[model samples]
Target: MDLCFIVILLTFDVKSAPNPVNIAYTSVALSLHTDLVYMESPPGLQLLHCLRFDDCVEGGESTYLDLFHVVEEFRKSHPRYFQILSTIPATFHKCHYDRENPYHLVYQKPHIILNHRKQVVGLNWAPPFEGPLLVEEDDVLMYYEAYEELAKAIKNSDKILTYGMKVGDLMIFNNHRVLHGRNEFKLNDGIRHLQGCYIGIDDFKCKVQVLSNQVGDGQPPKHVGNQSWL
Candidate 1:
């Protein structure tokens, strides 16, 4: 209902080695906006920094300074403000399916334990959808480092409300547009994972238009090595 900006930060260090997450995110943000804040570290840590501060091995200081970089890819893509946010540690568990694979619940079954007591809710799925994949909330994990950036973006975006997100999956969206989220998840056995990125809607529209033109010309979209057109 109102314009907003979100910035999610992982307390972990990101300036030690090459940060694949920041490097990859820098590339994406540059596509959408040009006025980005580049990390101040040397080029060696371009894509090898740690994302989840709570999830990496310690004693890797000089090799793991928390370096944050912003790029033009984020600004030119959209004409709005971006915000950031953060999430505490959480765990996800595997899904338990029925004989017919009819899911007992979708989304995530987030749980928490205190004093050795565990709490939970009945099975619940999300988005009112069905697919061949039997994705369980437990399958989620806080795996990727780039996700903390993405989450921060979502938190500080204009007119975007992320319902919360599952860890581990790659969820892509427009940087300056669109909304995203994940159902709440549980914490048992200590596993959390989430991964994602942002793309400009203009770029996506261009790709779709190109694909449509190709199809109209009686040619399938170009393919390489069994992969769809990039």
Candidate 2:
């Protein structure tokens, strides 16, 4: 019964996926509200850390990678079914205007690429996009609450496979429908370290949005061009 409700709220149509799971513009405003509210939710404290590209450690947080500690911390809020992947490979997938056509070997940022073209290497300016979004990878634990929320949200998705979390904090989930990711990241500080730990996505209801809401919500802000499919 609850599953059906979540499916309705998240997918709108039983046979489709949420057009924009992240919930941009309209949701952006909601996100600010949600962030404030979620932050106030004590248990949700460790759920996420929305930081800029410059606050984390260098080497994309990889150098300071510490999954064990993160897992231990997550266990305080959620302890149950969870997996941990020791290491995951990083990709050079850029998230800028040129992201659609990725250059595996060539860096994506204009400044970085230009300097590299002129033979200036080792200069690491933060990657172009703000940060990676939700997705998943292998061997990571999901937090109980987040795990529950994601499970309820993605009960119907298939093509998406797993969700690689954006570049900020780790994604804690249930492992079933709540998939996780290591994400392609670059350093803004010391190193880029992302971790995960989860239990399930059961308790939380999917207040996300349904399909009817998706088509409407997916529509870009009025200011954009006729083709607001961004």
Candidate 3:
């Protein structure tokens, strides 16, 4: 991907006024969500580099949840709800003003995406951008109930990891399989800034393949089927 189009530098500081564009621009706690759920094909890999983290700052711990495990647990406990969420499409929208390019983006996709073998592979869940009910009236209640259950599980799950990122910390994760958020923070003595960039999964995979071919014998591994790339 072109560096000019793929990189996004993010600065998290207390703004004078609330920006309706994104919650990350504010100091409030951001809910656990997958980035760009409003897009049909969201970025695959996310990289965050912390440039500044003052000791005076409080409550700015980063949290991450593994959606793959969450979905597995949900399927075991609430099979029907899992089925509904995996099949029904929900609409997500983002309408914000940009001086250079104002935009309103919308997309419809099931909260859980499955692979050809019916295995959960991707997810799209963002409460902030979730649009109005797209399902029938009869199914709305069930949908919300399932949604609420899932949300609660994500928040209360013991697997969630919280880390206070320090200066020079770089965090990278698979955007498709992980849900990320941050706690409400207060900037007292210094500023908090983070630079970020996205790399397409295909590009990353190609690089890995090239490296492997250059270093390995010309034959594929015999245990390839047992290996899980994701």
Candidate 4:
């Protein structure tokens, strides 16, 4: 019908393949990570609508965590590691041909992003999608150490949330601020299906600002993953 943006909807279905490439389509657990870090600006907001999740499914609970909250604590404890990750650039790539169409995307960015005042504002920390590390000789060792420490901190953080999705469940979250993943599940003769979409940070925040002025909703600006340190 030509009604909406192309590639606007991404479907997640648990099915078997001769050699499954995409983990989202396989019945396996996924580590926590952000989506499409290969893009210059990864999606800001993510929406998922669960169309079917049978009651008999063994274990397919979705999980999420606020990276900002974790980063705040990491900065307090490992300030130097945080700074290293923020300054050193890491490469993220998406070169796959498993689907009907091929994808060859690449982007380079620091795992952490900071503003002039050195406050952590944004991040591009997706391990599964990470490409080769191409940096200066000195930064090679330093980046790995810092990256390892940050990963350990993320694993030790206790702020992660878990939820089991049911039919008709619609979930929306700030993709930049939250890391998302799913646990491996056994179908047990049942099926699970989920559809997802993304809203650009620029567009989403523009609407919020315009509406705030139009309706006189004087609430302060909320940091909804637009790289604002506040």
Best by TM-score: 4
Report per-prediction Cα RMSD to one decimal: 22.6, 23.3, 4.8, 3.4
lDDT of each model, Cα atoms only? Answer: 0.25, 0.25, 0.75, 0.81
| Leading candidate by lDDT | 4
- Per-residue lDDT tens digits of candidate 2, residues 88-144? 111223233444444322222211111222222111111122133222533223323
| Better candidate number, 1 or 2, judged by TM-score | 1
Model 3 clashing residue pairs (backbone)? none
Give the range where candidate 1 is weakest over 10 consecutive residues by summed lDDT: 36-45
lDDT of 3: 0.75
- Candidate 4 versus the native: TM-score? 0.88
Q: What is the RMSD, in Å, between candidate 3 and the native fold over all Cα?
A: 4.8
Lowest summed lDDT window (length 10), candidate 2:
31-40
- Model 4: residues with Cα > 4 Å off, grouped in runs: 1-21, 216-222, 228-230
Tens digit per residue, CA lDDT, model 4, 121-182? 78777899998888889899999999999899877778888899888999998898899998
TM-score of 2: 0.18
Q: Per-residue lDDT for 28-49 in model 1, tens only? A: 2111121111211101101122
| lDDT score, candidate 3, position 132 | 86
- Writing each residue's lDDT as its tens digit, candidate 3 over 198-219 gives 7775555545555668986644
**Candidate achieving higher TM-score, 2 or 3:** 3
